[model samples]
Target: MKAFILDHYKKKGPLRFGDMSEPEVGDDDVLVQVHAAGLNLLDSKIRDGEFKPILPYRPPFILGHDMAGTVIRVGSNVRRFKLGDEIYARPRDGRIGTFAQLIAVNEADVALKPSNLSMEEAASIPLVALTAWQVLVEAAALKKGQKILIHAGSGGVGSFAIQLAKHLGATVATTTSTANIELVKSLGADVIIDYKKQDFETLLTGYDVVLNSLDGDTLQKSLNILKPGGKLISISGPPDPDFAREQGLNWFLRQLLRLLSLKIRRKARRHRVTYAFLFMRANGDQLSKIATLIEDGIIRPVMDKIFPFAAVNEALAYIETGRSRGKVVVKMR
Candidate 1:
C-alpha cells in the first residue's frame, strides 16, 4: 500500500510517501479503501512534535486523522457495516492513518457517511464536526437562548461550531478577519468580530460559553466575555489537569499539565467561570447524529480546497498559512 510515513518529528517535516505494509484488521475493525481525507492543524502540530508528551507517535508512523471511504472488508465482530458500505471517521488517536490508500478503523469509531455529501465533503466533517459536538453538546451542554462565542469562525471547527450553536438556539458570536465576516454570518453567526479591526473583549459581555481555538492571549481574553458560571472551552489548548487525568497520564505528566494550566485555571476561577481543555475523541454515534443534521440541512460542510493525493504536502502548507476559510481535503482516489 502507498502511504505517507512520518520518519521522524521535525518542526517543518514533510511526510515521506512510499510503500507500506497493509493495515491489519482487528475483530471489531473495518478495512476501508480511502477515497478522500481531511487536513487539519492537528496533523501539522503532531508532525512538528507538539503533542509528543501526550500523544507520542514513534517515528515511522502513518499520518492523517479524518477520512471518508468505502468498507471493502469487515472484521468478525463488526455487524453495523459490511463490505461496500460507505463510511467516514476520525479514527481514534494512535490508530489514525487516513492519508493512505487504505486504513483499518475500529467499528465503534466509524459511521455511515451522510448520503447527501460527496466523499470529499464527508471526509472534512468528522474531526471538526466531532470537535464542535463534544464541546457544545457533551461538555458545555449549551442550551437554548444561551449566548456563546465561537472564536475563529472561519476555520474548520469554528465554522461548524457556529452553525451547531445556532441550531441549538444559542446566540452565536464569532471572531474572524474582515474578509470572512460575511462567511461567518452565512453560517448563522449573530455577531461577527473582525479581529483585525476591533477587540472582541471590549465589544462582547456576559456570554454563556466561549469556545477558544486561538493563542494563549486570546484564550485569556475569552474568560472575561463569559458570564458567571459560564464555560470556557478550548480545543487548541494548554491541556488542563482534567484532560491529563482523562488521558490517564503519568503522575509527572499530570503534574506538568497541572502546572501548565494553573495560571489560566486560577484566572477562570477568579472570574467565576469554568475552564476546560477539550481533546475530542472518536465516536461513531455522534458522527451518525451529525450526519442526520447534515442530511436535514441544519448544518453543512464548509470547504475551502481539495488537493490531489500527490499534493498532500502542498495542502498541508496551504492550511498552515492560516488562510483557509474552512476545511481542506486531499483526494486519495
Candidate 2:
C-alpha cells in the first residue's frame, strides 16, 4: 500500500511518500479503504514534535487524523457495520493513520458517514466537527439564550462550532479576518469581529462560553469576554493538569503541565470563570449524531480545497499558512 511516512520529527520537514505494509485488523476493528483524508494543524503539530511529550509517536509511521471511506472488511467482533459500509472517523489517538490507502480503525471510533455528503466532505467533518461538538455540546453544556465566542471562526473547528452553537440556540460571536467576515456570518455567527480591524476582547462581553483555538496570549485575552462562571475551553497549547491526568502522564509530566498552564488557570480563577483544556477523543456515538445533523441540513461542511492524494505535502503547506477558510482535504480514491 502507498502511504506518506514520517521518518523523523523535525520543526520543518517533509513527509516521504512510500509503500508500506497493510494494517492488521483486530477483532474489534474495521478495515477501511481510504477515499479521502482531512488535514489539520494537529497533524502538523505531531509532525513537528510539538506533541511529543503527550503523544509520543515513533518515527516511520503514517500521519493523518481524519478519514472517510468504505469498509472493505469488518473484524468478527464488529457487528454495527459490515463490508461496503460507508464510514468516517478520527481514529482513536495512538491508532491514527488515515493518510494511507487503507487503515484499520477500532469499531468504537468509527461511525456511518452522513448520507448527504461525499467522501471528501465526510472526511473533513470528523476531526473538526468532533472538536466543536466536544467543546460546545459536551464540555460547555451551552444553553439557549446564552452567548458564546468562538475564536478563528473561519477556520476548521471554528466554522463548525459557530453553526453548532447557533443550532443549540445560543447567540454566537466569532473572530476572523475581513475577507472571512461574510463566511462566518453565513455559518450563523451573530457577532463577527474582524480580528485584523478590531480586538475581540473589547467587543464581546457577558458570554457564557469562549472557545479558544489560538496561542496562549489569545487564550488569556478571551477570559475578559466571558462573564463570571463562564467556561473557557482551549483546544490549543499549555495542556492543563486535568488533561495530563486524562492522558495518564507520569508525575513529572503532570507537574510540568500544571506549571505550564498555571498562569492561564490562575487568571481564569481570578475572574471567577472556569477554565480547562479540551483534547477531542474519538466517539462513534457522537459522530453518529453529527451525521444526523449533516443529513438534516443543520450543519454543512465548509471546505477550502481538495487536493489529489499525490499532493498531500502541498495540502499541509496550505494549512500551515493559516489562510484556509475551512477544511483542506486530500482525495485518495
- Residues forming the 10-long window of minimal summed lDDT in candidate 2: 236-245
> How many collisions per candidate?
0, 0
For model 2, residues 85-180, the per-residue Cα lDDT tens digits are 999999999998999999999999999999999999999999999999999998999999999999999999999999999999999999999999
For each candidate, C-alpha RMSD in Å? 0.5, 0.7
lDDT per model vs. reference:
0.96, 0.94
**Which one wins on lDDT?**
1
- Candidate 1 has its poorest 10 consecutive residues by lDDT at 4-13
How accurate locally is residue 237 in candidate 2, as Cα lDDT from 0 to 100?
Answer: 66
Model 1 misplaced stretches (Cα beyond 4 Å): none
Angstrom error of the Cα, residue 67, model 2: value is 0.4
Candidate 2, residue 156: Cα displacement in angstroms equals 0.3
